[model samples]
Target: MAALYTTRSLSAYADLLDHAGILAARPEAAAEATTTISFATDDSREVQPGTLFVCKGAAFKREYLVNALAAGAVAYVSEVDYEIDEELGRHVPCLIVSDIRATLALIADALYDHPSGRVSVCAFTGTKGKTTSVYYLRSMLAEHAKEHGLPAPAFLTGVEYDDGVEQGESLLTTPESFVLERRIAHAAEAGCAHLVMEASSQAMKFKRTLGVEFAVGAFTNFGEDHISPIEHPTLEDYFESKLLLFENCHTAVVNLDTDVAERVLAVAQRAPLVERVLTYSLEREDADVTVQEFERTDGGIRALVRTPRFTRWLLVPSPAAFNLSNALGAITCAEALGMSANAIEFGLASARVPGRMELYPTESGRVLGVVDYAHNGMSLEALLNDLRAAYPDRELAVVFGATGGKGVDRRETMGEAAGKLADRIVITEDDPGPEDPAVICDAIAAAVSAQGHQAWQIVLDRSEAIETAVRETAGQAVIVVTGKGNDPFMLRHGVREPYEPDGDQLKRALAEWDAAN
Candidate 1:
C-alpha cells in the first residue's frame, strides 16, 4: 500500500468530527464512493489532473489555489465556504467543511498513514526554553541510541538535524498539520525509534497540532504572549492553549517554578489518559528535577542539577536561570526516555540555543553584554531577573521592544518589569510589520513612565539604538540587547529586510567605544 494519499484517495474527515465529539453525522458519501482526489500543499505542487489544493493559515492565500490549480489541482481545502470559481475549481471537486483547521488535522493523519500512532513522541511547550529543551532531549536520545548501537532517534525542532533522514529547517515552532505529519512520516521511514518536538501555544490556538499524539510533554513557563488579532486574545487564552499540550501527552514534565505550575499539574493529572508526571524547578526544593546549587564563575554559571534518579554538576556559558530551567526540562524528559547518565551529560554540555541568552565580552569596556530572544513578558522578566542577580552591584541598560501586533500587553508588562528592574531603557524597533514603529515604542514608553522609570530613550534604528545604549553605559554597566535574538530578518510593513547588526553589532560597537576611549 502506498504511504501518501493520491488523487484517488478518500476522506476520513467525517470520522474526525465524531472523534472531536461534535454532534455531526458521518457523510454517507464519504464512506462509499472513493473520491479520487489530489491535495497539493507547498510540499508537492506537481499533481495529476485531479488534485485537492489546500491553502492553510499564516502562509496560505487564494493565489496558492490559483497556482496549484494551474499545476493541476482539481479540488481545494479552503477556510472560506464561498467558491473561487473557475472551471478547474468552480464545480470540479472541493470539500468545503465547516472548519478547515479540524479538517486539515484529519487529512494530515490520513496522509502520513497516522505516524503518531506508531511512534512515541514528546512535545515541549512554553514562552521560553521550548527550542533548547527539544534540542537537549533530541541530543540525549540520539547519543543514547548511538552508544547502544540502536537505530538513531530523530527530531523536529526550530533548528533541524538529519543523518540523511532529511531533517529540514523548521520555520514555525509548530508547523501546519499537513507539513508536520509529512515530516514525521519522513522520520519514521528513516528508522527513527523516537521523536521530540517543540510545541507552541500557537499550534494549539490555531489547531496546528490537532490529532497529533504526544507520549511526553513539558511546560517550561508561561506569561504574557501572542496577544494580537492573529494570535491569542488574552492571558487566559494563552494559558488555555498551553494547557492543551499536557492534556494530549500521556506523561508530563512540568515546571514547578511557574506561577500556575500547581494548577496546570493538577489539570493534567486529572485528565483521564495521563499516566505519569514529573516536575522540574529552581525554587521548589521538592521537585523531581531541581537545581540543588547554582554557582557563577568568571566563565559562566556552573551548578549541580539533581533529580531522584541522579545528580551532576553541569557547566555551561548560557547566562540565564531561564536557560537553566530549559536545560532541566530537557534533562528530565531525556532521562524519562531511558537515556543514560553519559548521554544526558553529553547533551547538556553540548546544547546551545542561538537566540536565547547568548553572552559575549566587550573590548572597550570591562562590562559584559547579552543578546536574547526574550520577546514576551515571562521571558523578559526572567532574563532581567537573572541579569540583576548575576551583577548585583553593576548598573543595567536594556535595549529592546515589543513586536508589532502583539499589542501592549506584553510591551506593558515588559516595560513595567524594566522600570522596576532596569537602570536604563532604550526602546527600539523589533519587526514592526504593518504597524508604525513609534506607535509601538509609545506603548512600551507608557508602561515604563506609568511606573516612573528614569533615563529612558527611544532610537528606532535598531543598530543606532544598541550603539546608543552601549555608548551611554558608563564603567561596570551591562548592555542587554533583546527581542530578536538570532533571527536573520527585521520585518517592516510586511517586508522582511536585512538586520545583520544584531548581537555582533553590539560587540563591535562596544569595541568602538573602547577604541574611542
Candidate 2:
C-alpha cells in the first residue's frame, strides 16, 4: 500500500503542537527531532515503519504501544508517558501534550497536508434529520457536479462513507481524526469538488473534527437526546457540543422552526470564524429559505418553496411532512453553495436516504409497511404523527427496541411516544450488548404501561418480532419497523454478530404473509 501522507520531520510536529499551546514537552534530544514520520494513526494495529502512533481513548493500553514499537513505529504521542522497560521494548522518542484529542486532530491535519483546505467541505449537526439532510445536500451537489462535468461529491453519514475513491458502510457517524483526514485527502486527490459530512455531538465534544475548516456548516434542529453518563450528562452539554461546529465554519445555516432557534442564532452570530449566517424555516416568511405551503401527494409531498434567488414548487418523494423541513434545509445549503435552481429541484426529487422513511410494498394492498431509523423519542414521535396524518383511516403498529448500555433514558421516551401515538407496539431486541434482551424490553414495556396503553407485546428475536407485527396486523394497518434500519450487524456482548437488516426482514415477512394468504 502507498503512504497516505508525506513524510515530515519530528520537529515540524513539535513546532505545530507548541504553537497550539498544547505541547507540554518536546523530544528529549535534538537528534530525535530530525526523525521522519511517514504515517500517523491511533490504531496500534495499523502501525508501520516510521509511524507516529497516538495514544487516545479511555480503553487505551500500554501493550498496544509496545506492539506499535515492535512493528517499527518511530515515535508516539500521548497525554501521559508509559515508562517502558528497556529490556522488554525498544526506547523511542515521544511527545507529551495537555490534550491528546486536540493534538491528534492537529497532527493528522498536518500529515494529510490539510486536505479540508483543498475540498469544499460542508457539515451538518443536529439531534435529528442530520443523515437525511446530508443525503439531500449530496444529491443536489452530485447532480450539479454531473451537469457541469465535475467529479461527484463525497459524503460521510451514519449509513455510509464515500471518499470518491472508495465507498463502504460507516462504523461511526463521525470517524476519528486520522481516518477522517485521510479520507478527505483521498477525496481531494480523486478530484471531488465537495465533501458533505455529519458533525455528531460526541465527535465535536471530543475534538475529532478540530482542525477541519468547513466551507458551510448547518444546524438542522436540536432536541433532548443522547443524555446518559457515558454520553452527554445533560441536555445543555449536548446542545453546546453541537454548537462547536460554527466555530470553524465560514457560513452558518440555522433552522428557525426549531424551539431553540434564538439561542442557536445568537451563538452563530457570536462565532468568530462565522462570516455569514443564513436562516431557513417551515413557518416564518422572513427566513432565507421558507416553505410557503405544502400538500400530500400519492407519490410524496409537494411544497411551494421560496428562496432568496427563486420561488418554485419542489417535490420531495416521501409521504412524511417532516421531510419537507429536511428538504428545505438541503435547499438552504445548496443555495449557499451557489447551485443552480434546476440542480436543486432535480436532486430534491431524486434523493433517497437508505433506511430513512423507506416504504415497502405489500402483496395485499390493505397493508402498508415503512422502515426507518427513528430510535429516539423526538424522531419517533415525528415519524408516527406524520404517518397518522398520511394514513388517517389505517391502524398504526410500531416495532422497536432501545439500545443497551447507553442512552438509558431513551427506553421511557420511546415507549411514551409509541404508547401515545401507535395503536399496537412490539418490543424486541436491538443491539442488547451485554444486557439481557428481556430486561431491556421490560423497561420499555413498563413505560408503555405507564401511558395506560396495554396493547403491547414483547418478542425477543428481531426477525420474529417483525414477522409477528406484519402477520398479526394483516389488514388496514401501517406496520412501522424501526431502530436498526439498514445496519447489518447486532452487537451482542462485545461481538458484532451478522443479522438481517430490518428492511430485508420486513420484506421477507411481507412475502410470507402474501404466500400464506
Candidate 3:
C-alpha cells in the first residue's frame, strides 16, 4: 500500500465531523487529539500502526474492531462506541459520528487531499451502456493526452480499473468511498490529467461518491433494472439516484432518445452545479450531437455524427449498432472537454471493451459465437433484437441465467425476450448468491416456456452451457453467451467460486469442435 502523502491529527477529524453536523461524541483522551494518523481503513485485516479504523456496514462486528485494535489501530470512528477493554493495555481514541458512511467519505476526501479537484473527472450513469461509454470516453481522452505528450488517462468501470498505479479487474461497479478517493489520488499523483468512471445508482444513494465533483457527467439511458428489496425498492428511486450525478457535474451529457429524456434534461438543467447541458440522440436532429446515419461495415460500424464543433464521419471498430449511441455520448463529453475532432475519431475507431459485443473465431468459420455483459432484462432484450436483425437468416441461440437474490425481475424479462427472439435457449447459473442455482434456472425456464419456446434446457454449469450451445448450433446459427461476460468468478452461496469467463469458454468450445471435425 502507498504511504499517505498527507496526514491529519485526531482533532482535525473531530473538527471535520463536527462541522459536517455528524459528530456525536469526541474522544475522551485530550492528549490523543494531537496524534497524527498514518493511515485509515475500514477492513480490520488491513489495519497498521497509527491506523484510524472506520466501522462501516450492517455486517460490522465488535470482533472486527477488536482485531483492528490488536493490529495497532490508534484511533477509530463509528456510529456507536465499541468501548475498549482496559485489559488490552492500549489507550485508543474514539470519534463517534451519527453516520459512519458519510463520515468515512468526508475523512477519505480530506485524507486524499481532494484529488478529484486536481484531475479532470468524468463519470457516466445509467442502467446499461455505462461501462461501454466510460471506455469510449477514456479512449478519446487517451488520444488527446497522447497528442499533447501527457500521461494516459485513468479509468474505473465495471469490467476493470486503470488508476495509473494499478490495473486489474474491478469487483464493484463503483468502489467504496475510501478506495475511490485513494485511486483518484493515485491518478493525480501519476500526473494523469483525466479520470473517467461509472456512477452506479447504489453509489449515489449510499453516498459512495460523496465529495467527488465530476468535470463531465453523462447519462446513457434508463431502464427497469437494479430493482429489488436490497437494491432500489422502486423504479423512481433508481432513476432519481442516477440524477444525482448531474448535481455534482459542470457539464451534463444526456441521451435524448431515452424514454424519460425530457425529465432527465429538466433535472440536469435545474441542477445548481451543472453549467451546461448537452444532448445526443439517434433519432433527433435538435440534440447537441446526433447520429445522422449509421451502418455496419466489414469489420466495424460507420456513422455520420453531427456535433456543434464538427459534422463528419466516425467509425467504431465494433459490429454492434448500439455502440453508436455510446460513441455519441463519448463524443459529446469529449467536446465539452475541448478535445479535437481528430482525437475523437481516432480514439473511437480503436476503442474496444472486453466481453462487450466480443466475437469469437470459430473453427468451421460458419458459426458465430458472441460474449456480452448484457445481464438485465432491458439490455438482454436489446442485444437479442440486435442479433436477430444482424443475422436474419441464421437461427439464434442464447445461453444466459439470471443472478440470484437481486434484480429478481430479470428472470422473467430475460426469458421472455430470449424465448420470443431466439430459436434455442440454454438456461444456466449466474451468480446464485446464497440461493439455489437450480431454483433460479427453473424460474427462467418457466418464463421461456410461457413464450411457447420449448427449445430450452437447464445446464447448471455455465461453462458447459456455453459449450453445449456452441456444439448444438454449430455451422448454422448465431450463439450468444450473456450475463457473466469475462468476469472470473461465480457467486455461489455468498462465496465467489473460480469460474472461466464466457469468452474463453466459447473459444475453447470452438477449438474443440475444430479438433474433432
Q: Which candidate is the best by TM-score?
A: 2
Candidate 3 similarity to native, TM-score: 0.95
Q: With candidate 2 superimposed using the best TM-score fit, by how many Å does residue 214's alpha carbon deviate from the native?
A: 0.9
Q: After superposition, how far is residue 4 of candidate 1 from its true place, in Å?
A: 5.6
* Deviating ranges (above 4 Å) for candidate 2: 1-3, 83-91, 515-517
For model 2, how does the per-residue alpha-carbon lDDT over 1-517 read when each residue is reduced to its tens digit? 2655878888888889999999997776674666888888898889989999899978899989888988978888999877664745556788889999999999999999899999999999998999999999999999999899999999999779999888999989999998899889989989999999999999999999999999999999988899999899999999999999999999999999998999999999999989889999998999999988989987799999999999999989889999888898889999999999999999889998998999987776777889999989999999999999889999999999999988888899999999999999999999999899899999999999999998899999999999889889746888999988789999899898999999998988887887777
> Positional deviation of 357 in candidate 3, in angstroms?
0.4
Q: C-alpha displacement of 124 in model 2, angstroms?
A: 1.1
How are the candidates ranked when ordered by lDDT, highest leading? 2, 3, 1
Tens digits of per-residue lDDT for model 1, 1-517: 2445533453444344446654133324743246555454533365446565555666666666677767776556555543556544345345545666776776776666677776778888888778777776777787787887767766776645452257655567788887787767766776677788888888887777877878888888877667777678777998999998866678888898878988889988887668888888888888888888988786556879887778988765576666777888888887677677888887667666676677767664477888887777777777889899988988889999878855557778888888888999999999898789998989899989988987898899998999898788778888889888877788888787977847788878888877776
Q: Evaluated with lDDT, which candidate comes out highest?
A: 2
- Which candidate, 1 or 2, would have the higher lDDT against the true structure? 2
Model 2: per-residue Cα lDDT at residue 238 = 96
Candidate 3: Cα lDDT at 199: 95
Please list all clashing residue pairs in model 1, or write none if there are none.
7-36, 7-37, 8-36, 38-51, 38-52, 39-52, 364-514
Clash count per candidate: 7, 1, 0
Model 1 per-residue lDDT at 446? 91
What is the model-wide C-alpha lDDT for candidate 3? 0.89
Query: For model 3, what is the error of residue 277's alpha carbon versus the real structure, in angstroms, after optimal superposition?
Result: 1.3
Give Cα-based local distance difference scores for all models.
0.74, 0.91, 0.89
